[model samples]
Target: MFEQIIAGIEGRIGGPARKVVVDRGVKPDNARHELGRHNPKVVIPLGREGIEMVAAGNPDVPVIAGAILHPSPSTARFHTTVTLNTDPLLLFGRLKSVAPATKRIIVIHDPNKSEGVIRAANDAAGQLGLDLTVIKVRDRRSAAWMYEAVFSSIDGSKDVVWLPTDTTTVDDTVILPLILEQSWKRSFPVISSTPSHMERGVLLALYPDYSKIGNALGSIAIDAVGGGARNGAVFSRQVQAAVNERTARHLGLKLSDDLRRQFDAVFPALAPLSR
Candidate 1:
């Protein structure tokens, strides 16, 4: 990922002739070696540790990050922070494509963690003419109960459950199995931001396009210092979709070969023929 990011940075800065400093939360002495006399115009970090490392070095230097989790107070340090969470609007739009009859988008999330996501989802629902049913839960216990209630009311023919990137509201070990079980029994579709969920019977997943995300980060970083990029969170528009073909078959979807071709991945990939 960082290699793609470096390639992206080099692309924007007139190719490989220009060097972008790379650091992995190294000690101060090594930091000097990595950053010494570079006087970098921008810094792109990986995680919280990287963010802190770069920010501590020069708070004013523009920092662009990708693949980080929900913003905490600490994230304010970055001039631009791109989250790993897929954009709700984009996700909803894909949901519309895969399940055109879906009328309601159901989600259980922590209000504090998913404020922006819900806000965008509401707009997307309105534009797509789908009902957005959002339930806020403060913790895992409440989230579990809420999931049961919400799953019970789900109209399989017209409702799609959304599993966002929120760990508090969607723990893999506990909540994922419950949702999958409900989905199987009820015959409803489930969509997630996490791609690996497709292997576990999720109908679809929309995840980052690493190259495009890296390029976008480099673009934003360049604009931050030179063209004045906005200082806030934005979702990665460059995305790829994966589908569970078995799940689609279960839902009775008759997607054409062209539509199937569009997907970046398909679950239960065919095994090679023996020689």
Candidate 2:
């Protein structure tokens, strides 16, 4: 991800780039050491520490960053943060395309962590003519109970469960397997934000397209450096889709060749028949 972002940065600037490695307990002088005597026009911080360093020392430069938690808005003229949160509008648009008959979208999330995502999902679902049922859970135990309740009641043909990017509510080891197993038994479609979940029996998954994200960051940086408009807290729009053909078969989805072409990855490749 860092490499791609660098490639994009250099591609836009048409020049060599300097990289500053930031880690825990690292001071601001380390950034200055890498930058030497020249002040950078833009600073792209990789982690939370990097952001702190920038805020403490070089608050004047335009900044663009990605893959961090709780990105605070900067007072700089151009501060763009590439959030890792999955865009619910884009996710639901894909769902509407693939599952046209889907009428209800069910999601279980931690209210504290996913209030923004749930609000966006509600708007997206309304626009797509899908009913949105958002169940909030405070802890993993409550999440499990909520999942069981939702799984038992939803109609397979009309309802699809959305697994958001919230790790608090969607514990991989505990909750994921339960959801997948119940989905197989109930024959309901399960869409995930994690791509590998498709291989583990999720009907469909949406994940970041790294190269596209890098390119976008690069473009934003270039524009920012050129005295363009400021962009704050931007969520990634470039996404790739994955589908499990075996799960599709189980869910009675007739995916044509054209539909298959839409997915970046498909699971369980068919083996050759015995000769």
Highest TM-score against the true fold, candidate: 2
**C-alpha positional error of residue 128 in candidate 1 after TM-score superposition, expressed in Å:** 1.2
TM-score of each: 0.85, 0.89
- For each candidate, the alpha-carbon lDDT, in order, equals 0.77, 0.76
Model 1 quality (TM-score): 0.85
Best by lDDT: 1
lDDT of 2: 0.76
- Deviation (Å) of 243 in candidate 1: 1.0
* Candidate 1 lDDT tens digits, 1-275: 65765676667666562444445655666554455566667767766666655655554567777767666565676787887778788888877777889999899999887887788889889988999898999999999999889877778999999988888888888888888888887889989999778888898999987777777887887788785855687767778999888888888776678878978997872211111
Runs off by more than 4 Å, candidate 2: 27-38, 73-78, 269-275
User: Per-residue lDDT tens digits of candidate 2, residues 1-275?
Assistant: 66776676677677767777667765677655554455788777755776666665654668887765335543243378887666878888887777788999899999777776688789988988889998988999999999989987879998999998888778878898888788878888889888767667788787877667777777887888899777877667878888788877778887889988988887872321111
